[model samples]
Target chain A: MNVLRAIYNFIFELGDTALLFLKALYWSFRPPYRWRELFKQMEKFGVSSVSVVFITSLFTGMVLALETYTGLKKFNAESVIGSIVAVSMFRELGPVLTALVVTGRAGSAMAAELGTMRVTEQIDAMYTMAVDPIHYLVVPRLITGVTMLPVLTVISDLLGVIGGYFVSIVLLKINSHTYIRQMLNHTDLHDLYSGLVKAAVFGLLISLICCYKGLSTKGGAEGVGRSTTQAVVISSVVVLVADYFLTAFMF
Target chain B: MVEETVIQVINLYKSFGKQQVLKGVSFSVKKGELFYIIGKSGEGKSVLLKHIVGLITPDKGKVLIEGMDIHQATGVDALKLRRKIGMVFQYGALFDSMTVYENIAFPLREHFSLSEKEIAEIVKEKLALVELEGIERKMPSELSGGMRKRVALARALALNPGILLYDEPTTGLDPLLTEEIDNLIKDTRDKTGVTSVVVSHDIWSVIKFADRVAYLANGRIEFIGTPEEMLETDNQMLKRFICARLEDKLMTSLFNACRSRGSCTS
Candidate 1:
C-alpha cells in the first residue's frame, strides 16, 4: 500500500510538474523577461559542462571501440568498426552518456542552488518582486537544457567517433577507408534524428527533475543535500527508462 | 496622529501535521508602524510572518493585507499583492551565485520596464541606502553577516514595497551589529514609510525600535501593547521572554528550534 501510494504521488507530482513546465514556457516568451539571466544559465549549463562531457565522451568512445573490435574481429567484421561506433554513438551512447554526466555535474548543482534559495527564501524573494520564480529560475534552465543538450550530444558523438577512429586505425590496424565506408553505409539521417530528439528529451527531464526537487526542498542545509541527491538519482533513472521506451518505439 | 491598518490578521491558524504552530493568532500593523513580534523563539513568529506574505497558507482564518484576503487570492492577484510587501529573511537569503548588485537589482529587473541605466540608478540608490555602495561586486559569501543583512534589506526595498516583513532580523548578530541593524530598520522605516513587521527575540530591538510589541506564546498572541506597556506587563511569559534569563532563553530557543526542525524533518 505504501509503495502504491508512493507511485500515485509520483504520478501526481509529475503531472503538476508538466503543468509548471508549460507555464514556464508560456512565461519564456512573455515580456519583462530576463535575457541576461537566460544567457548566464546557458553559460553555466552549457559552457561550464563542456570539460566533463568532453572527457567522458572521449573515454566512452575509446572503450566502445576497444570492446567492439575485440568481439567483431572474431566474426571477421573488423572492417565495420567505424559504422558500429558511429551508429551506436549517434543512436544511444551520445545522448545517454551526456545526460548521465550532466545529471551528475549540472543537475546536482542546480538542485543545490535552488534548494538553498528555497530554504533561505530567495525564491520567495523573487515572487515578492512580482517575478515568478518559475520564470526567473526554472524557465531559463529549461531553455538552456532543451537547447544545449542536443548540441552537446552532437559534440560528444563527434569526439567519441574520433576516439573510436584513433583506436581502430592506430591500435587495431583497420584501414581508415573501410572503417569510414562502413560507418557511412550503416548510419542514416534517421539514427541522428532519433538521437537528437532523445537528447532534447533528456535535457528537459534533467532540468525538470532538478528544478522540481530544488523547489520542493524544505529544512536547511541537510534538506538541500537531500534534494541534490534526489535530483541526480531521479534524473538518471528517468533518462535510462525514457531511453529504453524511446529506443523500442523508434526501432 | 491618525493610523491606517496596513495588515490585519483575523483568527489565523496554521499547523504542520498534528503539531500546531499558530492557533488563532491575530494581530494588526498600522500604516508606517514599526511592529515587532517578540517571543521566546518558537512561538510561531516566523510562521506568522510567512502567513502574512502568503508563503504559507493558514489552516483556518484570514490574512488581509491592505484589504485583499491573501489565502484566497488568485495567483495573479497574489502576485500583485506580494509586490506591495517585502521580506528580509534571518539569514539574509542573498543569492550566493549573484553579486550584491545583481541580488539587489533582481526585483527591479523582474518587475519594471526600466532601462539598464535606470535600473543601475535604482540599484545605486538602494546600495547607498544600505551604505553598501562600493561592494556591489562582492558575493554573499564574501560579505559579513551584518553586510549580508544590509544587502538583503536593499533587495527587499528594490521594489519600494509599502510593507516590509523582517524575520528575526538580528538572530545571529553580535551586540553591536544587532544595534546597527536596529538603527538601519528605523532609518529604513523613516525614509520609506514602509510598514515594518519585525519578528525577533532581541529584547533590545523590541525596546528601542518597536512602536508596538506583540508577544507570541502558546501559538497565540499572549500580549500586544506598546514597548513600555510590554515591559510593564505582569504576564510571566512576557516578563521572562523580555528579561532574557539564560534558562528561559534556552528553553524557548530549544522549544522553537525543536518545533521548526521537527516539522521540517517530518
Candidate 2:
C-alpha cells in the first residue's frame, strides 16, 4: 500500500512538473519577457560556476589518464591515453560531472531562494501584484539552465582535454606529438555535440525539478531546507538516470 | 448606510484535509468602509480575508468583488480584477533581496512602461504618505517591526489599489505602535477612499478604528455589528473574549472608559 501511494504521488507530481515546464516555455516568448532575469541567471549558473566545473573536469580527466596509464604502459600502448581521456571527457564525463557540480551549486540556490520566498508569501505577493510568479521567476531560470549548461560543458571539455594532455605528456613522459595526434585522430565533432545535447537536457531537468520543488514548498524554514536538499538530490539522480537513455539515443 | 458592496462572500467553505477552516462563512464589506474581521488566532480570519483578494479559492462558494465571481472568472479577466486589490501580509512579505525603494517600484516595473524618474517619484510619495520619509535604500531586515509594516502599507498603497486587505496588521507591535498603525489605517482610507478589510484580534484597534466588526469563531461568523454593538452583545464567545481582554491591567481602565462611553451593560 505504501509503495503504491509513493508511485501514485510520483506520477502525479511528474505530470504537474511537465505542465509547469510547458507553461514556462509558453510564457518565455510572450510580451513582458524577462530577458534581464534570464541573463542574470545565465551569469549565476554559467559564469559563476566555471571555477567548480573547471576543477572537477580537470581532476576527473587527470585521474582517468593516470588510471589508464598503468594498464596501457604494461601493454606498451601509453601513447593513446590522451585519446581515451579526451573522448571520455568530451562524450560523457564532462557534461555529467559539470551538471552534478551545478546541481549542488546553482540548482540548490534556486530552490532555497524560491522556497524562502514561498514560505514568506513573496510569491503570493507577486500574484496579487498582477505578476505571474512562474513567468517572472521560473521561466528565466529554466531558459538560463538550458542554454548555460551546454556552454559550461564546452568549457569543461576544453579544460578537461588540456588536463589530460598535461598528465599524458608532462607527467607520464609520453611523447607530446603522439598524445596530441592520437587525441585529434580519435575524437570527433559528433562526440562534442552529443555531450552538449545531454548537457542541455540535464539543465532543463535540474531547473524544472528545483523550481517545482521550491514552488510547491510548504511548512516554513524547515520546509525550505527540505526543498533545497531534495532539489539537489532529485536533480542529480534524474540527470544520471537520463544520461543512459540520452547516450543510447545518441548512438 | 447607503454604501454599495465592494466585496461579498456567500456560503464560503474551505478545509485542509480533515481540518475545516471556514464553514459556510458569509460576509460583505461596503464600499469605502473600514471593516474589521476579528477572531482568535488560527480560526481562519486570514483565510476569509484572502478570499476577498482572490488569493485562496473556497471549497464551495462565491467570492464577488464588484459582482465579478473570482473563482468562476476567466484567467485574464480575473487577473484584471485582481489588479485593483492590494494586500499587506501579516509579516509584510517584502522582497528580501530588493531595497525599500525597489520593492515599492516592483509592481510598477512589472506592469507599466514608466521611467526610472517616475518610479522614483511615486516611491518617494508613497514613503511620505506612510510617514516613512527617507530610508529608501535600506533593506527590510534593517527596519523595525512597525517600520516594516508601515513600509509594507506604503508598498500596498503604491498601486493606488481600490481595495486594501490587511492580515493581522497589529499582531506583534507594541501598544503605541499598534495605535499608530490603526490611525494610519484609518487615515489611509480617508486619504485614498480605498475600501479596507483588516483581519485582526487586537482589542484596541477594533475599538478605535472598526466601522463594522465581524466576529469569526469555530469556522463561522458568530457576530457582526458596529463596535458599540460588539461591546453590548451578549454572545458567549465574544463576551468571553471581551472579558479576557478587559482583564488586562493597562486596558481595564481604557475598557471601563470605553464601556461608560458606549452601551455596554455587561
Candidate 3:
C-alpha cells in the first residue's frame, strides 16, 4: 500500500509539474504582461549570480584540469589537456555545475519566497484579487529561467576555460600557446551551444519544480522549509540525471 | 434595498483524507447584509469562506453567487466571479516584497488600468477608509498586528468589491483592537453596502455586529437567526458553545439572567 501510494504521489507530482510548466509557458506571451517582474527576476537569477557562478566554474575547471593531467600524462598526451578541459567544460560541466550552484542560491530563494507566500496565504490574496498566480508569479520566473540560464552558462563556460588555462600553463607547465591552440582547435560552436541548450532546459526544470513546490506547500512555516529544501535537492538531482541524457542526445 | 440573496450555498460537503470538514452545510447571505458564521475552532468556517471564492470546491452541492455556480465555473468565469469578492485573511497575508502602498495598490494595479496617480489616490482613500494614514512607504513587517489587519482590509477594498470575506479578523488582536476591527467591519459594511461574511469564533463580535448569525456544528448550521435570538435560544450545543464566551460577561448586568441559571445555551 505504501508503495502504491508512493507511485501515485510521484505521478501526481509529475503531472502537476508539467501542467505548471505549460501554463507558465502559455502566460509568457499573454497580455497584461509583467515586464517589470520579468526583468526583476532576470537580474535576481542571472545577473546577481554571476560572481558565484564565476567562482564555482573557475574552480571546477581547475580541478578538472588537475585530475585529467596526471591521467593524460601517462600516455604522453598532456598537450591535449586544454582540449579535453575545454570540451568537457563547454559540453557538460559548465551548464550542469552552474545550475547546481543556482539551485542552491537563486532557485532555493525562489522556492522559499513562493513557499512563504503559499503558507502565509499571499498567493490566495492574489487569487482573491482575480489575478492568476500562475500568470503573475510563475510566468516572470519562467521567463527569467529560460533567458538567464544561457547567459549564466556562457559566463561559466568562459570562466571555466580561463581557469583551465591557468592550471594548464602556470601550474602544469603545459605552455600557454599550446594550451590556447589545442583548446581553440578542439572546441566547436556546437559544444558551447549544446551546453547552453542544456542550461535552458535545466533552467526551466528548476524554476518549474521550485514553483510547484512553492505553490503546493501546505503545512505553514515547516512546510515552507520542507519545500525550499525539496526544491534544491530535487532540482540538483534532475540536473545531474538530465545531464547524462542531454549529453548523449547533443553529441 | 438589501433584500436579494447574493450568495446561496446548498448541502455543501467536503472532506480531506479520512476527516470530513464540512458535511451538508447550507446557508445564504443577502446583499448588503452583515452575516456571521460562528462555530468552534476547526469547524471549517474558513473552508466555507474559501468555497465562495472558488478556492475550494465541495464534493457535493454548489455555491451560487449572483446565479453563477462558483464550483462549476470555468477558469475565466471563476476569475470573473471572484473579482466581485475580496477576502481579508486572518494574518493579513500582505505581500512581503512590496510596501504597504504597493500591497494595497497590487489588486488595483492588476485588475484596473488606472494611472499611477489615480492608483495612489485610491490607495490614499483606502488608507483613510481603514483609518491608517501615512504609513504606506513601510513594508508589511513594519506594521503591528492591528495595523496589518487594517492594511489587509484596505487592500481587500481596493477594487471596490461588492462582497467582503473576513476570516477570523480579530483572532490575534487584543480587546481594544478587536473592538476596533469589529467597528471597522461594521463601518465598512455600512459605508460600502457590500455583503459581508465573517467567519469567527468571537461571540462578542457576533453579538455586537451580526445582522444574522449561523451557528455551525458538526458541519451543519444548526441555528440561524439574529444574535439576540441566538442568545435567547435553548439549544444545548449552542448553549454549550456560548457558555464558554458568556463566562466573562456573566457578572455583567446584560448576562445576569443567563448567569443566574448557570446553564446559558446549554
Candidate 4:
C-alpha cells in the first residue's frame, strides 16, 4: 500500500509539473509581457551568478587538467590534456556543473521566496486581483531560466577552458601554443552549442520545479524550508540525470 | 434600491487529504452587505472565502459571483468575474518586493493599460482613502502591522471591486488596531457600498459591524443570522463559541482597565 501510494504521488507530481510547464509556456506567449520582471530575474539568476560560476568552472577545469595529465603521462600522451579538458568542459562539465551551482543558489532562492509568498498569501492575493500567478510569477522566471542558463554556461565554458590552458602551460610545463592548438583542434562550436542546449533544458527544469514547489507550499515557515531544500535536491538530481541523456543524444 | 445577491456558495464541500475542511457549507451575501463568517482557526472560513473568490475549486458545489457560476466559467470569464472581487489576506499579503505605491498600483497596471501618471494618481487616491499618505516608497516590511493591513486594503480597493473579502483582518492586531481595522472595514462598506465578506473569529467586531453573521463549526455553518439574533440564539454550540469569545474580550478589557488604574494583579 505504501509503495502504491509512492507511485501515485510520483505520477501526480509528474503530471503537475507537466501541467505547470504547459501553463507557463502558454502564458509566455500571451500578452502583458512583464519585461521588467524578466530583466530582473535574468540579472538575478544569470548576471549575479557570474563570479561563482567562474570560480567553480575554473577550478573544475584546472582539476580536470591535473587529473588527466597524470593519467595520460603513462602513455606519453600528456599533450592531449588541454584537448580532454576543453572537450569535457564544453560537452559535459560546464553546463552540468553550472546548473548544479545555480540549483543551489538561484533555484533555492526562488523556491524560498515564492514559498514565503505562498505562505504569506501573496500568491493568493494575485489570484484575487485577476492576475494569473503562472503568468505573473512563473513566466518571468521560466524565461529567465531558459535564456540565462545558456549565457552562464557560455561563461563557464570559456572560463573552464582558460583555467585548463593556464594549468596545462604554467603548472604542467606544456607549451602555451601547443595547449591552445590542441584545445582548438579537438573542440568544435557544436560542442559548445550542445552544452548550452543542455543548460537551457536544465534551467527550465530547475525553475519549474522550484517554482512549483514554492507555489504549492503548505504549512508555513517550515514548509518554505522544506520546499527550498526539495527544489535544490530534486533539480540537482534532475540536472545530472538529464546531463547523461543530453550528452549521449548530442555527441 | 432592490437588494441583490452578489456572492453565493451552494453546498460547498472541500477536503485536503483525509481532513474535510468544508462540508455542505452554504451561504449568500447581498450586495452592499457587511457579512461576516466567524469560526475558530482551521474551521475553513478562509477556505470558503477562497471558493467565493474562485481561488479554490470545491469538490461539489457552485460559487456564483455576480450571477456567474465561477467554477464553471472559462478562462476569460473566470478572470472577468475575479476582477470584480478584491481580497485582503490575514497578514496583509502585500508584495514584499514592491514599494507601497507599486503594491497598490499592481492590479491597476495588470488589468488596465494606464500611463504611470494615471496609475500614480490612483495609487495616491487609494492611499488617501486608507488614510495613509506620503509613504509610497517604503517596502511592506517597513510598515507597522496596522499600516500593512491598511495598505493591503488600499490595494484591494484599487480596481474598485464590487465585492471585498477580508481574511482574519484583525488577527495579530492589538485591541485598538483591531477596532481601527473593524471601523475601516465598516467605513469601506459604507462609502463604496461594496459587498464585504470577512472571515474572522472576532465576535465583538461582528456584533458591532456585521449586517449578517455565519457561525462555522464542525465543518458546516451552524448558524446564520443577524448579530442580534446570534446574541439571542438558542443554539448551544454557537452560544458557547460566542460566549467564549465575549468572555475573553471582557476579561481583556477588564484587565486593561485595572492595569490602567494601577490596582490589578494577574
Candidate 5:
C-alpha cells in the first residue's frame, strides 16, 4: 500500500508539474513584458554563477586529465589524453557539473526566494493586485535559466579544455603539439552543440522544478526550507538522469 | 437611498482534506459599509475573505463581487474583477524585493500606461491618504510592523479599488498601533466610500469600526448583526465568546494597574 501510494503521488505531482510548465509557457509569450525582472534574474543565475562554474569545471578537467593519463599510459595511449579530456568535458562534465553547481547555488536560491514570497503572502498580494504570478514571477526565471545555462556551459567547456592542457603538458609531461593535434582531430563541433543542448534542457528542468516547489510551498518557514531542499535534490537528480538519455541520443 | 450589495457569498462550503473550514457560510456586504468577520484564530475568517478575492475556490458555492461570480470569471474578466478588490494581508505582504515607492506603483504600472510622473504623483497621494508620506524609498524590512501595515494600506489604495478586504489587519500590532490601524480603516472607508470587509478576532476593532459584524464559529456564521446587537445577544455561544474576551481584557487591565502601583502579584 505504501509503495502504491508513493507511485500515485509521483504521477500526480508529475502531472501538476507539467501543467505548471504549460501555464508558464502560456504566460511567457503574452506581454506587459517584465524586461527588468528577466534581466535581473539573468544576471543572478548567469553572471553571479560564473566564478563557481569556472572553478568547478576547471578542476574537473584537471582531475580527468590526471586520471586518464595514468590509465592510458599502461596501454601507450597517453598522447590521446587531450582528446579524452576535451570530449568528456564538452559532452558531459562541463554541462553536467555546471548544472549541478548552479542547482546548488541559483536554483536553491530561486526556490527559497519564491518560497519566502509564498509563505509571506507576497505572491497572493501580487495575484490580488491583478498581476498574474506566473507572468510576473515564473516566466522571468524560466527565460533566465533557459538562456544562461548554455552560456555558462560554453565558458565551462573553454576553461575545462585549458585546465586539461595545463595538467597534461605542465604536470603529465605530455607533448603540447601532439595534445592539440590529437584533440582537434578527434573532436567535432557536434560534440559541443550536443552538450549545449543538454545544458539548455537542464536549465529548463531545474528552474521549472524549483519554481514549482516554491509556488506550492505552505506552512511558513519550515515549508520554505523543505521546498528549497527539495528543489536542489529533485533538480540535481533530474539533471543526472536526463544527462544519460541526452548522451545516448546525441552520441 | 438603498445601498446596493457589492460583495456576497452564498452557501459557500470549503474543506481541506478532513478538516471542513467553511460549511455553508453566507453573507453580503453593502456598498460603502464597513463589515467585519470576527472569529477566533483558525476559525476560517481569513479563508472566507480569500474566497471573496477568488484566491481559494469554494467546493460548493458562489462568491459574487458586484453580482459577477468571482469563481466563474476568467482571464481578462477575472483580472478586471480583481482590480475592483484590494486585500491587505495579516503580515502586510509587501513585496520584499521592492521599495515602498515601487510597491505602491506596482499596481498602477501593471494596469495603466501612466508615465513615471503620474505614477509618482498617485503614489504620493495614496501615501498621504494613509498618513505615511515621504517614506517611499524605504524597504518593507526597514519599516516597523505598524508602518508596514500602513504601507500595505497605501499600496492597496493605489488603484482606488471599489472594495477593500483586510485579513486581521491589527493582529500583531500593539494597542496604540491597533487603534491607529482601526482608525485608518475607518478613515479610509469614510473618505473613499469604498465598501470594506475586515476579518479579525480583535473584538475592540470590531466595536470601534464595524458597521456590521459576522461571527464565524463551528464552520458557519453563528451571528450577523451590528456591534451593539452582538454585545446584547442572547445566543450562548456568542456571549461566551464575548465574555471570554471581556474577562481577558479585565485581567490585563487589573494586572497593568497593579504593576503601575508596584503591587503586582502572581
Candidate 6:
C-alpha cells in the first residue's frame, strides 16, 4: 500500500509538473516579456555553464579512451579504438554524461536561486510589477539550455575522439593514421545528429524540471534546499532514462 | 460618508488544508482612504491583502475592485486590473539582482513603451517622492532596511496605481524610521490620492495613520471603526491585542510553543 501510494504521488506530481511547463511556455511569448532578463538568464545558464561542461567533457574523454583502448587491445582490435571511442562518445556517452554533470552543477543551482527568490517574495514582486516570472526566469533558461547543450555535446565528442587518438598513438603505440581512418569509417552524420538531438532533449528536461521545482518551492530556506536536491535528482534520472529510449530509436 | 468605494470584499473565506485563515471576512475601503487592518500575527491580515491584489483567491465569496469581480476576470482583464493595484511586501521584496534604479524602473519599463529619457524622468520623480533620488545606482544589499522599504515604495508608486497595498510597511524598524515610513505613506496618499490598504500589527502606526481601522481576530474581523472608536472599545480581545497586555503576550507565546511542538510531533 505504501509503494502504491508513492507511485500514485509520483504520477500526480509528474502531471502537475507537465502543466507548469506548458504554462511557462505559454507565458514566454506573452506581452510584458522581459528581454533583458531573458538575456541575463542566458548568460547565467549558458555562458556560465561552458567552463564546467568543457572541463568535464575533456576529462571524461580521456578516461573513456584509456578504458576502451585497454579492453579493445586485449582482443588485438586496437585499430578499431577510434571508432569505439567516437561512436560511444557521440552516440551514447557524451550527451548523457554531460547532462548528468550539468544537472549537478547548473540545474541544482538554478533551482536554489529561484527557490530563494520565491520564498523571499521577489517573484511575487515581479508579478505585481506586471513582469511575468515565467518569462523573466524560465524561458531564457529554456532557450539557452536548448541551444547550448548541442554545442557542448559536439565539443565533448571532439575531445573524446582526440583523447582516444592520443592514447592510440602515444600510449598504446597504435598508428595514429590507422586510428583516425577507423574512426572516420565507422562514425557518420547520423551519429552526430542523434547526439545533438539527445543533447537538446536533455537540455529541455533539465531546465524545465529545475525551474518547475524552484517556482513551486514553498516554506523557506529548508524548502529551497529540498527543491534543489529534487531538481538535480529528477533531472539526472530523466536524462538517463530519456537517453536509453533516444539511443534505441536512433539505432 | 459620500466617498466612492474603491475596494469591496464580501464574505471572503480562505483556508490552508484544514486550518482556516480567513472566515467569512468582509470589508470595503473608500477612495483615498488609508485603511489599516491590524491583528496579532497569524490572524490573516496578509491573506486578506493578497486577495485584494488577486495573488491568492478566496475559497468562497467575492473580491471586487472598481466594480469588477477579480477572480472571474480573464488574463487580459486581470493584468489590467493588477496594473491599477500596487503592493509593497512586508520584506520590501526588492529584486536582489537589480540596482535601486532598475528596481524602481521595473514597472515603468514593463507597463509603458517609454523612451529612456521618459523612463529616467519617471524613475527620478518616484525616487524623489520617496527621498531616495541619489542612491539609484546602489544594489538592494548596499542599502539599509529602511532605505530598501522606501525604494520599494518608490517602485509601488511608479505606475501611479489607483490602489496601494502595504504589508507591514514599518515592521522591524526603529521608532524614527517607523515615523518616517508613516510620513511617507501620508505623503504618498496626499499626492496620488491612491486608496491605501495597510496590513500591520503596529499599534502606533494604526493610531497615527488609519482613517478606518479593522481589528482581525480568530480569522474574522472582530471590530471595524475609527481609531477613536477602537481606543474606546470595551472588547477584551481587542483591548488585550491593541494594548499588548501581559496576558495577550503569554497567550501568543503559548500558541507559538504549541504550533512548534505540533510540527515536531508530526
Best by DockQ: 3
> What would you estimate as the lDDT of candidate 2?
0.89
Best candidate, TM-score-wise? 2
TM-score of 1: 0.90
User: Which 10 consecutive positions of candidate 2 chain A have the poorest summed lDDT?
Assistant: A29-38
How much lDDT does each candidate structure score? 0.87, 0.89, 0.89, 0.89, 0.92, 0.85
Better of 2 and 4 by DockQ: 2
Best model number under lDDT: 5
Give the C-alpha interface root-mean-square deviation per candidate. Answer: 1.4, 0.8, 0.7, 0.5, 0.3, 0.9
lDDT of 4 by residue, A151-203 (tens): 99999998988898888888889988777788789988888888889999999
Clashes of 2: 0
lDDT of 6 by residue, B1-266 (tens): 67899899999999999999999999899999999999998888998999988889899999999999988887879889888899999889998988999998888877779999999999899999988878889999999989999999999999999999999998898877887888789789988898999998977677666789999999889999987788678888898776675565664454445334422112
- Mark the 10 consecutive residues where model 2 chain B has the least summed lDDT: B257-266
The alpha-carbon deviation from the true structure for residue B100 of candidate 5, after best TM-score superposition, in angstroms, is 1.0
Estimate, for each residue in A3-50, the C-alpha lDDT of model 5 and write its tens digit.
999999889989999999999999998988999989999999987789
lDDT by residue (tens digit), candidate 3, A1-251: 99999999999999989989888778777888888988899989986688999999999889999999989999988888899989999888889988999889999999999999998999999988999899999999987887799899999998988898898889999988878888889989998999899999999889889889989998988999999999999999998998899878777
lDDT of 3 at B34: 95
lDDT of 1 by residue, A1-251 (tens): 99999999999989988887888888888866668888898888888788988998898889989999889989999998898889889999999999999889889989999999999888877776767788788989998899989999999999999999999999889998999999999989888999999999999999988999999899999999998999999999999999999999888
User: Model 1 off-target regions past 4 Å?
Assistant: A1-16, B244-266
Which residue pairs in candidate 3 have backbone atoms (N, alpha carbon, C) closer than 3 angstroms, thus clashing?
A: B239-B265, B239-B266
lDDT of 2 by residue, A29-139 (tens): 887877777788899888779999989888888889999999898999998998899899988999999999999999999999999999999999888888889899999
The 10 consecutive residues of candidate 5 chain A with the worst lDDT sum are: A242-251
What local lDDT does model 1 show for residue B12? Answer: 87
Residues B1-266 of candidate 5 have per-residue lDDT tens digits of 98899998999999999999999999999999999998889999999999999999999999999999999999999999999999999999999999999999999999999999999999999999999988999999999999999999989999899999998998877777887888899899999999999998877677666789999998999999987688777888877776675574674465346434433222
Taking chain A of model 2 alone, its TM-score versus the true chain A equals 0.98
Q: Report the error of model 5 at residue A162, Å.
A: 0.4
Q: Candidate 5: where are CA atoms >4 Å away? A: B245-266
